[model samples]
Target: MDEQHERADGPFRARGGPPWRRGGPPPWAPGPSWWDHRADGGRLPWRSTVLVTVIVLAGSTMAAHGRAGDRVGLDVFAYLLLVLASVQLLWRQRYPVVIVYGTALCATVYLAAGYPYGPVFLPVALGCFAAIVAGHRYAAWGAVALLWAAHTVVGHWLYGYLPPPGDGPAAWAQEAVVAAWVLAVVAVSELVRVKREQWAQARVERERAARRRADEERLRIARELHDVLAHSISVINVQAGVGLALLDSDPEQARTALTTIKAAGREALGEVRQVLDTLRAPGEAPRAPAPGLDRLPELVEQAAGAGLTVGIGTGGKRVTPAPGADLAAFRIVQEALTNVVRHSESRRAHVQLDYRQGGLTVTVDDDGPASHAEAGGSGNGLAGMRERAAALGGTIEAGPRPDGGFRVVAELPLAPPAPLSEDSR
Candidate 1:
């Protein structure tokens, strides 16, 4: 990745799109809150547990009053059972199995004691829901099933032996109601579990997509900065050297070299500003059109200032390509010439533009005596060129020529030629 991207601005801001361009929850959309993260893990749910306990205690007391004659009244033992069941809910996130069993057992004992039934079942329902949602399905199901079975045996057969002295077997309709309630709890828990899993999966996908977008944007900015600075600086360097060499011996020539340096610097500043404007105000229209093949003449002029002669040639039919291919072709040629100016002792480079029925081909060649000693290039120009080409379903080949020079050839796909129709022919 070229390091031209501004880290502080971030990828979303650099893309010149709206605040919610991609991978972000839109402003109108509701996002997960701090409470939402508490679904499974994090801090213990202290406030919720205390609230449940309070409600259960008050409800159980009210039931004792409503059923004063039918069953045992709310005594200290009955109150303790309700508290135990509701309080165990605190650890449902971390120890759901234990809470499920504890609550289920507490509710069974209270019912077995012949106490009035009311909010006494609320804690058991909550425990089962938590356990199931926490993925302890078997434990939750078995705990509820065993509790219901124990209640059935006790209410029907063991009641005479254990509770309210002479209460007989529970009605079959009562067993049916209990079974229905258990089914409802499991169904609700399963629904919530599915929703939570989907939410988590979507969140993962969104984050992954956001990271990919950020990296691509960074690379693009880096490539642009590299090309702009490398080409312009190469020209400035050459001009500055000429200016110093002729400072006293040839005052007029030295002054011309300084002027060329200034021109190159100004042009570089303008292009750099254009590249950075996207990062600074991503939502605005560009200050200038992107450079394309039409700028090849300007590149030739710039290379001349760098003391490198460039010969441009064209073959095949000339046709306009898509905007992207035009830009890649231009940049590929620019970077190839910049590399030659910086690393080759040759004073002349050749650029060939071949437009074919299939696509556009750009080639840059420079004779070289391998000046690696003075080649201060960071080596990313060719990589950036290849990246630009590949992004447009194109290919790039760059290497030293077998006999003498370094060559860069790029094949960038244009829009498919429109189908021929009957015309003047």
Candidate 2:
């Protein structure tokens, strides 16, 4: 059977067994005959049904004509054998080997009874073809060998024994013809089986590739959302704490902190909404370009507003990286600064950007109190930063500094972006 059909059919059951064992309708049920449909849907197997029907009709007509001169009793028995053999062809695809065996047995009986040869051989030949096409190559060939032996032995018994050696070429030619026909059927069936398997394998690979793409897209969206929310929320958290502390003694400073918190919240909401909108409708134009090195000063200002004095320093000639690498670099710095504001109990932090020959390096260090030794030790923030760096073929290191406070360093390669395919355009 085709692999697709086999999967659809649920599982194999012993031939002629109870249908209920396989959760199928009884074999003799009158309504919507189980034999008329395949497992792929409830749709009728019209093509197979028509093919089997035509073969049976043609074979029966030829058999009746061949046996017209035989004894009435013998003719009736031959017709019975022909019917038995032909009826099973309908189920050849579902129980190919079984049908082959049954048809071979009926042919053997017909030959033994001395019925005249005509279409009596058709069913057995078709059964062999069906079995091989359904992936029972060995079984189909074995049945052919069995039928050949049965015919030879039965012919010798009914008629005079063959003359020794080179009496004539007629018998040899006949045997050769039968063998060639069976071999031809097997060869054709094998070719079709190989092609079917190749097609099925290709289909499976396509599905796997599609699933992998979906997983990567999901991860990209998650990373973007994490960067936006973590940084913005961290800034808001710090500003809110500062506002609460200064409310009584310094009303002006408290108002400034409140303004910073509101700004941070709005910015976070806008970026998050942009990410979500892109996810919801990918066909739309992108809301805005992603944050990159150009935004570092804004990030430093945000951190400063959150009560952390931040200093920025740069080295080497500045060069813009590819879009993906740029976004990764920006997120790494943002996440690091967010960690500084949230975890470090220090008043001062430093961000250093170094543009080198092949890549860019970002280092964030904070002079926080030693009591907060576990600051930025390990969490989703650091993990997200590491993931972003790694995706761009880069690396990140985060730990406490030997002097004081915590430090996070990321190195991002500045590779060119892959060109878009024509289909993408």
Candidate 3:
């Protein structure tokens, strides 16, 4: 079970997904003026603000004309209060906490002056809405509460002393209506705020998934090109040396060496071109099927061209692995034999594949006297093989064997591994 789990350093190590965004600071918290304020990006909602201002100014005038007897008619002071409340909304997004209180206070004064009720409370509703959506719940609730308290005092107790003289106390039924309106406005604002936060989180998740997919694509391409070029180039290097050494004494043998070099070069160019075409237009279908365990004979023939003989064997009932695992097994074997031809004086290598119900095992071995001078190639081949196995819920082992020479064993499960959880990361 442990062997079937992914390694801590696999390519998909960070695939659990991006961390969530931290909640913004409270509105009343002191900071730079712009901190944790705006809702719809940084730009002000100037067009909507201006439109609301226009509608409120006209709507308030119409509403004032319709008030009950003894209610004061619209005066210059009442219109000025309405204008101040409407215009203050321009900065609602940038300073929601300030806007809410500013608009609420304007409405309280307008009512206390005995101005006729109209759409006068619209600006207060908008300011409270903006504040709540900007993550200033306490500020929003307080603004509305203060407005309610002031309105109750003026209508019930202070009516004897203030504005449009000879008016009696407000009815109990009217207070209940005002209370219901308050609750509705607050409840609606809270619902909208929640939806906006959910949408923002979803956008962040999409961006993280795109970046993760791109990283995986780059890694897969790097491994495929490494395996393709390394084996082909190693074969060409050996054949070229043979061709040059025998040009005078054995023309027939030298011709065969040159022919092998051509074949290896053609194969490398073809594979490299396939990789480039895939990059150029990712949506295009592949020109050829990916090589798999069935292609081990090609590796054997290529090794022969490099003057090394490779033996192949299989054990247990043969069962076909998935496309990805089959490709990984093929690359591991090719890389191991490439090492044998390039860095070992031994002229022979052996590859074995063992099939089972749960997984497939690949092993490559050689009898060797190490060629120390050429043993210092970049270690990407082994790392790539390890990545491939681990990517498929498998494990890899590669090192010098006890008696002599190097060996590599890969265990690739039939199923892919699940991504690491956030806690695991």
TM-scores for all candidates: the values are 0.80, 0.77, 0.83
Residue-by-residue lDDT tens digits, candidate 3, 1-425: 01122212223347542222235543333322424444435777778778877887788777776775658888898888998998888888888889899999999999999987778788999999988887788898999999998989999999999988998899888888877888888999999888777776665455556556666777788788888988888898889889999999999999999999999999889888988888888798888888899988988999999999999999989888888898899999988998898888899999999988879999999988777765434667888888899889899998888999889999998655676764464
lDDT digits (tens) for residues 135-244 of candidate 2:
67788889878988777665455344332222222375676776787678678777876776677666545544555566667677777777787788778877887899
Which residue runs of candidate 2 sit more than 4 Å off their true CA positions? 1-47, 59-74, 111-122, 129-137, 155-170, 369-378, 416-425
Per-residue lDDT over 1-425 for candidate 1, one digit per residue giving the tens place of the 0 to 100 score: 24554333244465765445665544334222313443444778889999999999888888888987778777899889999999889878767888889999999999999998888888998989887776677888999998889888987788888767767788989999998998998889889877877786776556555665677788887888899999998899889989999999999999999998998899889999999999899789888999989999999999998888999999999999888788889889999999888889999999999999979999899988667657566888888998998788789999999999899999988873343332411
Judged by lDDT, which candidate is best? Answer: 1
What local distance difference test score does each model get?
A: 0.83, 0.72, 0.83
Give lDDT: candidate 2, residue 349: 86
Best by TM-score: 3
Cα displacement (Å) at residue 21, model 1: 25
User: What's the true lDDT of residue 29 in model 3?
Assistant: 34
Looking at model 2, residue 297 earns an lDDT score of: 84
Q: Per TM-score, what order, best first?
A: 3, 1, 2
Which regions of candidate 1 deviate over 4 angstroms?
1-76, 87-98, 134-139, 171-173, 415-425
